[model samples]
Target: MDRTESKHVFVIGLDDFNLAELQTVRNADEYEFHGLVDYDTMVHPPSYPMDAILAEARETLANAPAVDAIIGHWDFPTTSMLPILRREWGLPTPSLESVLYCENKYWNRLAGQEAVPECTPAFQGLDPYSDDPVGDLNMAYPFWLKPSVAFSSYLGFRIDDEQQYLQAMATIRDNIHVFAEPFDNILQYSANRAALPDHGSGATCIAEGLISGRLCTLEGYVHKGEVVVYAIVDSLRASNNVSFFSYQYPSHLPVGVRNRMISYADTILRHIGMDQSPFNMEFFWDEATDRLWLLEINPRISKSHCPIFQIATGASHHEVAIDIALGRKPNFPRNEGRFPIAGKFMPRVFGDTVVTRVPSREGIETLQKQHPELVVHVAVNEGDRLSTLRAQDSYSYEIADIFIGADSESALHDKFRHIMEVLDFRFSDVVPTNYN
Candidate 1:
């Protein structure tokens, strides 16, 4: 296999240990992990400026000999820098224009509408200050309020009324300053926290209220302008909450409905001119209308898809993504016959801190022992303070995820329910009198 050809890969923004895990996996495969260029190194360090951090990243890459590729997942704008690196090192990558169009929400939506008008939602860009902020309230009562340039759902709000609309806008203006700082700075903290959630803050993005329905995600590999979707998973969000709680593969959707969803996705990717790259596209299916709405498209695969691919098809998304990044065809035919179901259950919280006794390790272990088909990855440790339910909450408490594979959708749901039963946490402490 010529494993020693010196394939130096640079992964930027190792914010939340995602890069660390990825590097660990890559190393196991015998590929040299050249280095990591992160924004967290600058944000927490006092007196750090954009030029200083950029200079450091450049120097790091320059010092590494024969770098083969630069990659990042989860963080968008930071990931967008791959094109810039390619330009600097003369490495091949998708066009910069394509990357920008994908990274910028306003442009991506506009382009998606031009290409796949049916899947896209009714969206508008308002002058947060002057334009009739609430005028669009007529378009849809519960339309989402999202920052034109935002990530992770931090500034997104679901405006059910004029009052909430005004309040959400105010919060967005006050907290989000995406343009003021270097794009790298905004993503660095979340990236680092993703790796070591217990050690530091996590990452977040804003979103208006959700489009009420089941959440489905599509993952694909694009080659020479052609997109091949490998999997579509049905996501289970937190009850009465907007954040995602779990994802189940072999989506429960009828075959016909799944085909339509994929068709819409193809229209979207083609319209955005994203012919090459790994893509993660999210959509919402309203059973009432029996229609699917395109939510967003991520240029890279976040870690959430790892278990789905592993449990369902015995394939690794990490491996496939790496292959695509290196310009090689992914290996999936080995496990291509039957469609197995998979799911990832995210930890749900009721308050800021789960002061109750943590779930019994023995009990969780016993369940795992009983159900070897289930893979549980708990993100929070005992005594960890939980965060709110907003997208910004991702930066607060890391999630505990349970990945399971079952023979049917019902079986997957049953396993997910059992997991919640065995691993649930309860608060044992009394509320402080001064607490709000």
Candidate 2:
């Protein structure tokens, strides 16, 4: 609770939005955050230059005033590079190998099966480029297929038959390199690469048996071998059950279900050797059979849910990561906000289209004035085409992200619907033209 000087910390893929959230954490005045690299260089670029990015970061750090801590919140190469940077700076953080275990979906499922087979779904790895990609999978149809290293379900798909498998693999074979090449760059750094499956690589895919029901994420940190989880946020999905619909804090899942999730998460993280780091683990609860399934684990704070946490917990969950990066145990308070519930809503459209108009900045600001808890981030502008957007999930194009606080779930939905209606986004569908 006392400090004589500021601690300079560096954030991978830092942006103005999250920077504002980071500043609201405890002891904000005592911390100075330097953007290790801008957000667009990592997310907006057509391809990642992993080696060049690393070299630039190292050179920049070499010239900084101080490097007390390093942390990241985005998916790879941010997650993959955070451990690498921390190790370079001699700061307290998880080993890169442990992070790789979580980043590689194939390896992550393998570790989960060993630690919690009861909750682990059946999964098989496949090299998308192999001559017989579908034959490599031993599982039946109606499975989820995805690139091992992609985020936001960029290339993920559901396979119902052999025909669909081939179609998806064709797409993966063509576009997987956008993420894979950069990810392969990460794999070369692993001293224990041999210990993992040699057949495993970023270009590969994982086909997993379907698991469904209530979805939620447990967010916390492991400090000195102790894995502590402080929040379980519910993940509401679109009717299609693919893209995320919204995230609500202080999940309404049963207390018993929540405890089981925490127990399984602790066992798996310990087994994966994840210590001295922040992580968020996802899970699904099948209310029909009262069965629980492990979805995936991320070795960073949830960047999307950070804002909602600010309203629900009175501060962004980034506080947990900042404290951990500083080698201090997380002391994030819970349920201390003005509202009873808070959420982040992701509204999307299904087809390729061009944006015609977006809500005016002044109009959004006027709404924010009335509802201080509300924040709208418009992703596209006038005349922007949806298909060209990078890192979007296969099914839909997310046009904007809405964050708000409400007293109940019904209230949350009403608030979000009304907000979107007021924002009044206009779009024109793109028509396909036959090529001769």
Give each model's whole-structure lDDT.
Answer: 0.62, 0.88
Quick one: RMSD of model 2? 3.7
Question: How many Å off is the CA of 20 in candidate 1?
Answer: 8.2
What lDDT tens digits, residue by residue, belong to model 1 across residues 1-436?
A: 4666757777766654354445434334556665465645522232335556567778998787667777766454555667666667776566555655566565566676787776667766555654565664445567777666556665667777778878887877665554324443533423223221121111122233345677888887687777788777787766555767667776777778778888877777776566547778888888899877778877777567765666666555766566776777665424641347777776555446654556667877888787775656665566655553233443234346677777887776776776676666555454321101
| Shift in Å, residue 101, candidate 1 | 2.4
For each candidate in turn, the TM-score is 0.79, 0.96
> How much is 148 displaced in model 2, in angstroms?
0.9
Point out where model 1 deviates above 4 Å. Answer: 1-3, 14-30, 38-53, 129-140, 178-180, 183-210, 336-339, 359-375, 388-399, 429-436
Instruction: Go through the candidates in order and give the clash count of each.
Output: 26, 0
